[model samples]
Target: MTADRSVLPRQCRGQAGMPHEAPHTAPPCCAGPDRENHSGKDSTGSDAGSDAEGQRNQAVFTPDGLTARAMGISCAAACNPACSDPELRRLLTASGISAWQTDRLREVLALAAEASPYYRQALQGVDPASISARGGLHRLPLLHADVLRRAPLSLLCTSQDDVARVVTLDTSGTSGRPKRLFFSEEDLNATVEFFSWGMLSVGHPGDTVLAVLPGERPASVGRLLGTALENAGMRSVAGNMGQGAPALARLAHTEKAAVIVGSASHVRHLALAWQQAGYDPGSIHTVLLCWDSVPPAVAGLIRRIFGCRVLVHWGMTETGLGGALGCGHQGLHLREADLLAEVIDPVTGTPLPDGQEGELVITTLRRRTMPLIRYRTGDLARLLAGACPCGSPLRRISPGRGRTGEGITLPDGGSLYPADLDNILLPLAGLHDFEACWQPWAGTPLQITLYPAPAAGTDRTLRQQAEKALADSPLPAALTRHGGTMFHVARTAPQAGFGKRRIRVIPQGTPPLNSGESYHEQLP
Candidate 1:
């Protein structure tokens, strides 16, 4: 039986039935993507001239108890000679990226030394206090993934009673043993606050948001997203993607959803499903995407098909929840207040300058349950050179290339990224989405499969064109030699699990590949 849905409801209004372009009164209280910036210093926020500089620095949004600037965490004008301006120093020391994190980093190091056996042994002879300032994080050794897997419980700083959630991270064929992370109530609350800020970017009070991620499970992304929406005066519904698209459309129509959030491809799946079910995509004003890198073509197709704006969000289960979200101005804006970010040479682990592509490493500013110090995120990205157009002094980062572990490593040790494949395939006519896997073993050759977009037709000619194009590329030519190093490439309809987040690379048929297969090379 075919399902029918109506996009039109009695009210097509914005949140709480307020006018879409309505303005909030001056004196903004929170840091959200959607809120207007009125620093009250001058027309130009950051570029304000001399006399207004101090007053302009006070333009930072103070969300009640979250910022030290709000509470007046003080330091003498001469305490640190780095900055000539007192307000600038206060901003950096209080609410800026280095602000709270400088102090929090010290606390975590002390906690790791006191409680976690893994970090204690890892930090053997080092003094936690000496390495607690800005740039002090790099002095510490990298906490390898193996240590987290082998000594999982040894990473916990809090007792079981204080731990509210324990999430096992999927190595996704990158690591031998998966990492299990524990979080306290306060840690979870931090995620909720982050989400509140992210939601504020696209939504408003009393608007309904339909999420396709996990909703029913406790501490799940969807559930926490719902809680965050509630905190910001919005309603949330988790469609779960389990009951199929028609059911999801029904829920959205019933709730009058103004926004939809989902994993990378799942947003496309839901939007397309709603379209096919005869609902107007215009019913939803914005789309929020996370969990993977989106090709430029996919983003365009989604925008055209859905008649809406697309927001890219970056985060990990390890960082608690979302740490950064795109403000649609330039790159993704980092949550400098809660987390400090660094880009480092993947192989050498030395820090990279802004605008230089490298591996992203993070240090949680205020987490207590399981504090990760200078934890390697394995994602390849570069820091944006300047402030976001949205005018928040918080730093922004490039939407990353795929994970270092997700790259396809050849026998000779050169690598190809899934994003490289997306770049080649997404532009082709009749192409949808594709997944490539290599089963390199003693007898078997590497195997790759390309899936056509839904309703993109199963004609072999279109498939052959894609294959030939890929074969002509440098990546395939290197691997598809006549004798020693051999590989296989084929095309098929979308695989078994077509909708949700798809693993770009799989190894040995079952379990994910070990860390050796992952590549962290920076692209030009």
Candidate 2:
């Protein structure tokens, strides 16, 4: 949603132009000699009208204060002066991202043309300098995920020995091969530096952070985060999801951790375990939910259980493990310096305006190895339309809705996302986790299997609650307008692992019973 324009004065109905191939006569937003003109209002609490022409050729200032400027343009330097974090303040204070990104894009394209086989052919007739000069990077073709899955080596700019880390992402439920990401020492250090500064949004120096992310492997997210926390003058305790919630809670209590970082589900499980054992939260004042899209219900549950602030982190290994960090406001601040983020139509690959939901595409600016150019991240999100309430000038991406590629189609041809179910079911008091499947051949197309918490057991009340919530929800309710069994909720034995959750759609002609699920009778 855009900002409320009513707050601005009558004379503050400012206009701004978007970036195009042609150069602008007026100075770009925040780039001119008189930087003060970028401010919406002057010191006397009046509309600064003289700079209207310059502002007209620049980014839009919406009611909620979102600056819908061109991608890669840094506005963080115009952040509210009340900011406290020195590193964050310094990071935002630096501007001139458009020129910087142009230079970096040229460098990346040249390097890709010279070193990478995939880009050598993809960019065969393309001149790196001309490409950046003509229509910006948007004119370039999009790099799809299938390329990485099929041939990761072709995209690698560095030799085997120079690579410092390799992460293999599983695509078990999907048809494609698993994707492998290669990173160099320089790439890894850049991620560490980003984490050190970005983490300050939730933590400070001398604070202890309990990280519930995988750290056993070298250059794993948790290990790098631990390294970053230490670099930021904070203590770090790293653990993996494999270590049950109870053990992590004990570690948190023992170390008097001031911050906790984990996926939403892991943190929710930990909060439930901590509550069950009656453990005091102690020094824990903030929790950073990362590695996955956080459901509001899950965030609410964690906040209530621990009485701490909940922030979200959005990124993938494809983004060098650092994309955007939340400022506990409207949306996550884009990593504009190192990563150029753009929102594009998921189907057509057309760039969309800010606040329009689409596939998030990114291009790496600083990475020397395996740099991504116009890479399509299949997740559905958008650029936020207004300034962050916290007053940071960095462009922001709307939080993840769900993966467009993984959605399940109902019998009525409506789409159902795992996040749709997560938003409704995961918040139930007795539920620990759940899995969804599409079985159109069955009496009901939608099937949800609920796993109750260890202490909660397979209570009939929980089943009733799930049934009620599903029936009342708009998505499921709309599906049943045709008048058939809308959905079925069942109780199941708890699963061992908590890997990335997704909807399992039984392919056509496959017998539902042979899908490897041990189903019990539907809960009464």
Best by lDDT: 2
Tens-place lDDT digits, model 1, residues 1-524 = 11111111112112112233254432222223232221121111122123333333332221211333322444321121111233433344323445456666777788887888788887777776676445566778876666667777887787878888778775544547778888887777767766754575566666788887865568888778877776555778877655655577778877889888876466665666576667776777677777667766556555666666677788887788777776554577676656778888988999889999889988776777778777888888888775443445567778565776667666777776766666566555455445555545524244334445445555465567776766766666666652222222234333323132323433344543232222111100
Clashing pairs in 2: 3-63, 3-64, 65-386, 65-387, 66-386, 66-387
RMSD of each: 10.2, 12.3
Clashes of 1: 4
Candidate that would win on TM-score: 2
**Alpha carbon lDDT at 252, candidate 2:** 85
TM-score of each: 0.73, 0.78
Q: Write the per-residue lDDT of candidate 2 for residues 226-320, one digit (tens) a residue.
A: 77766545688886656777787887888888789998888888888888878885456778888877888788788778866677778888998
Q: Which stretches of candidate 1 lie over 4 Å from their true place?
A: 1-96, 174-176, 246-254, 410-414, 423-433, 439-448, 452-454, 461-524
